[model samples]
Target: MKKNLIKPIVAAALFGIATQSALAADRGTPREARELFDQAVKFMEANTPEKAFAAFNDRKGRFVRKDMYVFVIDDKGVYHASGAAPEALVGLTVLNTTDAAGNPLFRQMIDSTRSAPEATVRYMWLNRVTNKVEPKVTYVHKVGDYVLGVGYSAPRASADDARGMLTRAVDLVKKDGAAKAAASFNDRQGAFVKDDLYVFMVNMDSGKFEAMGMNPALSDTDARGLHDAEGHALVAEMIDKLKSAEDATVEYVWRNPVTNRVEKKRSYVHRVGNSLVGVGHYIE
Candidate 1:
């Protein structure tokens, strides 16, 4: 009986993991955001605004799950309902509100929806629960006099994509020197940053950040003592590994920008002159 039960239990566990992986992938795509927006629109059409607003504003509503949430705004960019925003945002005009990157995301959303039935926009936003800035891709659709939107945390770049970015960065550093390469890394819209994967450099001697493609604020700071979620001194480990060779790889638990959860990350580091250029990809 034990042996028979073990086989079925193992199969069930594998099935559960497969199903969850599919759901996770679905929730992180633009199609999912559009679908959730459509659901919010249907709710408003079926019920009165008061009833729909109550449902949409619910923190745990069907329209708001995972990292996606539905927000409703009037034609003039006044808030009608927000699934996970603070209560102070309701009934307020937010046309000028900007994302963490100073991009007028609300303004862009309004501009796109005013002319089209639906629009897709990308911006950087702060995850309120995690207090971390992350990239977001939002889908907005105009319904009657309201614009309904659902935004998903952007997906992480694949390991192959991240490896390619690192290769490019390494080649650039070899040809252009560290100063010129730092300029490229500073370009947030440049090739160094591809989706969720970005390049980071640290001066081996000074132990200071020379450049960070993801967050410019992290540049020019001492980061040698940086630790992972489990108190592992990740930067020190990288530096130690690079002391004997030109390249090294390290793995640790890190907060994933897409999921805002501590997950395993594998990083590739290359010693380029006095600086160490590296890139990492989260492992799901």
Candidate 2:
């Protein structure tokens, strides 16, 4: 099942297609989803839709692993095959199909085929294995007129993700130079900011802000004496860390802008010349 169909019961009645009703099982991992997608793509590349469909729908086939399975749709939203879903759904048009979150999952998937070679989209869907509505991260790759997709349950954000974003920002700074990188990072709609993850920088020697991903107004301000809710001197700590170590992590109680709640946060700061550049993620 590709999460939730817009009208499961109506489709079943009209087309005799029952795609979402299945036995509950363990959750699928992202790695398994990627592997299944690769295999299905290989099958498609071999110009064997019939064989690919067979492998996708076969209950005992390699493609049907745990809660992960393959599904294919043409650019027109016509289903060719649905692994782990009702076989009768093969020829039906899923143009109006939406996820549990009311997102036009299939329509967006098909439309994306025209714009990019591959793209990933997220929507709320019924996890047939868990029998619960959970967020799914689907990877879609366009092959000819068809879009091959496989998705896994999305995981929660973590500190490692925050560090990776900042590391990439540091690279951009080195490549694009500080002024250009600062402009990019300051853009809230830019790549440096996603979810609760964002990049910030300060002059380690002087504690003056060079850039702040979510708060551009704070840039160029002296924040050396800033402290968290628990009175942990955050900016001062970053300067000290950069003085002794190449890179370091600082933990303190800070407000999560999304939840508007004070929570524990861990920030990973890396020394980029005279600037202490970093990003932080809230933790439970």
Clashes of each: 0, 1
The list of candidate 1 runs beyond 4 A from truth reads: 1-153
Structural similarity to truth (TM-score) of each candidate: 0.52, 0.51
lDDT of each: 0.76, 0.77
In angstroms, give how far residue 120 of model 2 lies from its true place.
0.6
Candidate 1 C-alpha error for residue 109, in Å: 27
lDDT over C-alpha atoms for residue 36 of model 2: 78
**Model 2, 70-166: lDDT tens per residue?**
8888878888877655455678788887877688998988777678888887777766655556567788988877898988765335767887798
lDDT of 1 by residue, 231-255 (tens): 9999888999999999999999987
lDDT of 1 at 186: 79
Q: Assess the local accuracy of residue 182 in candidate 1 as a C-alpha lDDT between 0 and 100.
A: 91
Give the number of the best model, judged by TM-score: 1
